[model samples]
Target: MSKTIESIFKPHLKPKEVYQGGKNPPTSNGKKIYKLSSNENPLGQSPKATEALLKAAKHIDVYPDQTDIRLREALVKDFDGQLNANQFICGNSGSEIIDMLLRAFVNEGDEVIYSNPCFLPYAVFSRWYGAKQVDVPLLNTTYDLDLEGILNAVTDKTKIIFLTSPNNPTGTYIPKSVLDDFFTRIPKDIVIVFDEVYRHFADAEDYISGLPYVTEGHNVVAVNSFSKTYGLAGQRIGYCYTTQTIANYVRQIHKPFLLPITSIEAAIGALNDTDFIAETVKTVQVGRKYLTAEFDKLGIKYWPTQGNFFIIDPPLPEFEFTDMLMEQGIMVRPVSQFGAPGKVRITIGTQEANEALVKALKK
Candidate 1:
């Protein structure tokens, strides 16, 4: 007998909530529209990256290097050779690499653990892969990850743990000492995926990246992207650092030439543009401080952030507050779907944009 469409697919497959990224606000009174919703680099892409991208455009007829040798080599130099090229796996974006990691490690009925309010992809992909998800809520008072709760949630069926530093929306980060203790307690067999796309913005002295754990040969993967820091969101390029064993496994599943040659060249050029990186970081840090001070004066409550954005407990409902901002020709994120209802996430923008946001809030 012929099979029906539903019969061909796995029974466990079910629809999940799609990610709702920041959107452009409606035009208002011919005023300048400042999109502070997406946490994008307001200064734009680096000059060096644009130059390299244009140069690589001439070779559009040829496929990119399947091995990603040149790009990986650039990464090696960027990290001062602490991680070998073979340990890196380039992807269309850090998001894609994360999906690949889930595909590589998770199987039907296996459990995946993560904080309740996290980068949505973790829950979405876990469900897609037929893995049971364990949602550990963040600490109520501080909106910080409940590491002790996560450790207690673990079981033999657990396959992976997703950790996001300077966590999205809330923007809280796990301190080095906290993470060190957490690492010692976690089972070495379970793969830990650390998303640190915002590490460059986390200037706190106690914050740390998962690179050290990776170097220690623990079952850890550090995922990073050029999107946030290098203004390469349009390029859709990112990479991960992990043990050679896991890298090989993920590479085996990844199709060849998944990244465009131009994107690869752009990332390499961005890595070389250290001056631009420093400038972007400084701009974000300054803007963050300015916004924080303004919020304090206004008696607004918000979590202390280590990323380019922070979640605010606004006077009105989250959507209401966001709509109010939109009417003023400003765009910001309403993160109820990320599990923080009645709160909004605002990205730190340029000095002009920051001033405009403050002006709107004061009115």
Candidate 2:
């Protein structure tokens, strides 16, 4: 008799539900469809990045630099040499870098802590690695991270703490004062993984990036991505900056040539196109302001956002509200899966897309 598939794999590896993002909406009667579901850049990729991608396509047969030296150099220059080139590690996406860190640090039955309704990958990956998940609930109504609750949840078993500033779905961020205090309280042996994929879009005066903690000799790993800010989502390039010790450990487990040559070139090109980055930030800011004003006029309540997206508590059921938007040829994400049932997350898109959304709501 053939062996069962489950029997062949590790017994601890039970069937797990994977996280799903927004789906592409179908065209309705030739109506224009705007996808505000996945938080993608509405203005599209930079021309310089496109040019670099096309140029690198000519050398598809060649392997990428295993060391990722050029991309690291560009990042160092991008930050004005605030970080060293040797401290960076490139991956397929920010998600991949998080997974790599998990693999490098977490052992079976070790506890991992994070806020609920956060980036679900934290929970999914923790379970995959046999780590105990300690999810501290966010503060009610405000949807802010409960720093005290998180600190109280810690124990000797805790291995890593995942923090997403300007967090996904809710878009609320940890202020500098809160983070500074929280960092002081956290145990030194426990690793802190700061997912800052949305860092570029944040404009709040109190907001702070995690890079400073890494530079200050804390056990912090700050993950970033070219996907959102650079409009190179399709290229799938992400990276992290940390101390040499942690960076070395993550690099040891990484496979060579994981990044494509085109992706590397595209990221470098995106870095060089400073004007494009500025434009994307401005577009998101303008679109966000317009939507918030419309929401106010319509008496719609939404969480104030620092990221490019915001959460809304609709009068109708979350899924039902999403379906209504779908009928209007607009696709926004229902974020019940993020543990915030009855709320929907909408991406701030281009001027046309924002107007389309407001028009649909006005009907």
Candidate 3:
């Protein structure tokens, strides 16, 4: 509207892209869509967390704890039996954690190296901050990390490198030995961010989470979410553990009263409820196994998954296969967006939802 407003803008946002969220199913009175697109917990939010939210409803007039002291303390009790509170800064979502980290470290024109066909929002966010986003290909059909390619992608401008274990869409993870090797060659100054929202699903002994690296004094930010494991995505809660120095830097850039009061209470309740955590993991484990067996029986080619979602290279074009599924009121993500052009990423939902997809495929 004004020249001052126009002059303040940059070309990076000339055409801002919409973040592609998970599909919301239809209504006639809202028919439930078997939502397998986003790697959401098919089990729904934890009952204890829900109970806490309902109990906390009367406190809406009060502001949320700005520092999330209670939630941070809870995180310390859980993740910190090994690490500590000083290692973490809690946020509204895993995405918000990224925003805080970027604000804390990235300067204008710095280089950020992330895997191509990796997390889509990251590319958008990096460019928005005026940092260049470099995308490298997955080494094979599965989106496993290529340590050499990643090291080669790094440059003098590189500030951060993002690695997702049990990576989304394709569902492959880097083994500990490989990640150790990858970290060895990177410049000591460059920070590495590990997004492990789906780490709980991994059963492989070698499929390590990033906590070990953090313990060794590496410049790493390891953030796992309560949303996926505790089914609290609606509450938008996630936390990151970094070096105490990085945590201090991140705290300054974080928005005040960020995590809602009720959300924090819910997350605390979720943290305490170990029975629910065990049950959710078991249910997903059962569902994931059933889905894999069904895919194999159907003779459908699918990537071996260690996360909540897996990619299947369908017999048709990616969009065409997706359209067929959507018409049946089942929504799955097209893997083309993540660089697997002919595949679809299917979240392992309930036994029924997974079976429904298999039935749809049979047609």
- Provide backbone clash counts, one per model: 0, 0, 2
Q: What TM-scores do the predictions have?
A: 0.97, 0.97, 0.95
Model 3 stretches astray by more than 4 angstroms: 1-5, 28-32
lDDT of 2 by residue, 1-363 (tens): 888777777545687778886687775678898999888887899989999999999999978887688999999999899989989999998988989999999988899998878888899888888899999989979988899899999999999999888899899998999999998899989999998989988999999999889899899999999989899988889999998888887789888878899999999999999999999999999988899899999999899999999899997888889999988888999888888888999999999999999999988
Expressed as tens digits, the lDDT of each residue in 1-363 for candidate 1 is 888888778766645477776666665567788989888887889899999999999999998888787999999999999999999988999999999999999999999998967788898888888999999988878977898899999999999999999898789998999899988899978999999999999989999998898888888899999999999999999999999888877888878888899999999999999999999999999999999999999999999999998789999988889888887778988888888888888989899999999999988
Models sorted by lDDT, best on top? 2, 1, 3
Please provide, for model 3 over 14-118, each residue's C-alpha lDDT reduced to its tens digit, 9 standing for 90 to 100. 776646777666562565568888878888888899999998888999887877778888988987467777777888888888877776778788988888666
For model 2, where is the 10-residue window of minimal lDDT?
4-13
How much does candidate 1 score in TM-score? 0.97
Model 1: how far is 328 from its true place, Å?
A: 0.9
Quote the lDDT for 207 in model 1.
93
After superposition, candidate 1 runs with Cα above 4 Å error: 1-3, 25-30
For model 1 the local lDDT of residue 324 reads: 89
Error of 3 at 105 (Å): 1.1
